[model samples]
Target: MKRSELLTRIVITIFSLGVVALPLALWAQTPLIHARIAEGGGWNPDVIQAKVGEPLYLKFTSDDVMHGFAVGQMDMQPVDIEPGKVSETTLTFNKPGIYTFFCTRWCGLNHWRMRGTLEVTGSETNPPEPASPPLYVTLDLNLDAPHLAEVVPTEKASARRGAELLRQLNNLPTYQSPDYYRLRSSVQVFQDLSGSGLTDSQRWDVVAGIWQSNTTPEGFAEGKELYAQNCAACHGEFGGGDGVFADDLAAAGTASMQTMNGDMAMSMQTPANFSDPQRMLGASPALLQGKILRGGMGTGMPMWGSIFTHEQIWNLIAYMYSFQFDYPR
Candidate 1:
């Protein structure tokens, strides 16, 4: 090699070494976070600080059972940490905000308690505009209030059975409107169809059809997946409020309530049974949306507004109502 060429090659080698060393240096600075069952200590040093528009490196180790880590609302793959093993990942935040990091696995009954926050501060790349209020908020719904349906279908309602009736009805556009469909409960929609001369069952079928129209097969599938991953732990595979964690959740709640008041001590209420027609039929989709986004206050439900996208929330709503209406899988 020529003298000059040899010097150039040496310089290039040194530059590559620096590039590799920079990331290693950053990775070394990150402390190893530990994960364990909720009872043991869900996530140690759960709070983390990072700068916006900068890449972050993290290290994690499982002290007990297998655990997976993923940030809420992020599009990154989850990192699985085996017992006594270290898992490392990198992330970059573009905006300044608080982000949630949670365990993706069901380690135990209190698995939902495995959560942490990432506080990203620095210059905002693009300042986000305020979003409009959710429908439940604008409607001023009392989510905790008892909402019971006066009438329920004698048999399970079917969207396929009501499709033709939905198409033939006058003022159908009014009923098909998104605002109308989301704000009105199944029972309310059935009452609206009263003067149309359809039998009670058919009216409910029409309501089912109306709901089916608002969501697509793709939405339902996505919702089903999301529910399985996030909600099934608490609500159950069939929306029966009998998930593996249900009993434990009730006990945890009851324990907390006992501290609130001695005279009114009572066991915590069980998770809502979506299959209960009387309650599900009376509750509007908007109301369910509110309860989901805001969470069940003091009810052990975690707020998901920071985790799921708006479209995802709507998809969950559609999938949940499937417990009431027979929409084919």
Candidate 2:
């Protein structure tokens, strides 16, 4: 062939190779992440590198049973990952930070352990403002301390009665405020009401009113749904500590009596009984919020700081108080 013909053939061959190679390069950029139970190694490629304000494509598949894919602190619906099938989602982050991703479904006893992280890097045009400390932290509470109510109401407190009573009282304690309710327990509120001339039972009713006023019926329903999905396995449906894992937890505690600090290990202890008036009533909404957000230290309670929003955490706290008081339907 002539030199010109040979040059034309070389150019055509190079163009064909580039067309095939471009697609392969793009495919290589997106990785397939695998999901399995914690025992089976949890999420494969658990650490993902991403860029801020750029679309990140994640492909997922379950190695065993069905699993869910969700990023913490994100406002996206979870995608299901069925065994032998692939599920994918594309996300773009506005800020740069380390974000956690985890399974949304209750896969097993160790479901909470299935968590991973995404590291996003980029420049921010408008940096986020600093957040204030949580109320429990600001109050400097010892979350592990046993807080028992000094006075237990003879009858269940009624929110409907309290609302009527609230309208009649001219002077009221600051207990009605969200900040007050969050920081002070129902028992504390009852103590504060001693000067109000209301009977002990009436004081309890007023406390119930305060709780009811802070939350809505819709919020309670949402909280109940969240508890059933996330907490019922370890804390019974009725807020009793007789869940299916209670016995196993007790056994675990018996097996490991002491921890590294020579203190009794809370991990082996059964979950807290929300129905216990003394314990539940003594815990303020802020205290409960702290516990739910931070999780129990070495108590087998997983930290949900990343999983739930601040409003959702508050709603859960309000529902917890429902086990102690009777709110109007």
Q: Which 10 consecutive residues of model 2 have the lowest summed lDDT?
A: 258-267
The digit string of per-residue lDDT tens for model 2 on 62-122 reads 9998999999879898999999998988899998988999998778777889999999999
Candidate 1: count of backbone clashes, pairs at least 3 residues apart or interchain: 0
TM-score for candidate 2: 0.88
Runs in model 2 lying further than 4 Å from the true structure: 1-28, 258-266
Please state the error at residue 189 of candidate 1 in Å: 1.0
lDDT of each: 0.88, 0.86
Return the top candidate by TM-score. 1
Overall local distance difference test of candidate 2: 0.86
**Considering summed lDDT, which 10 consecutive residues are worst modelled in model 1?**
260-269
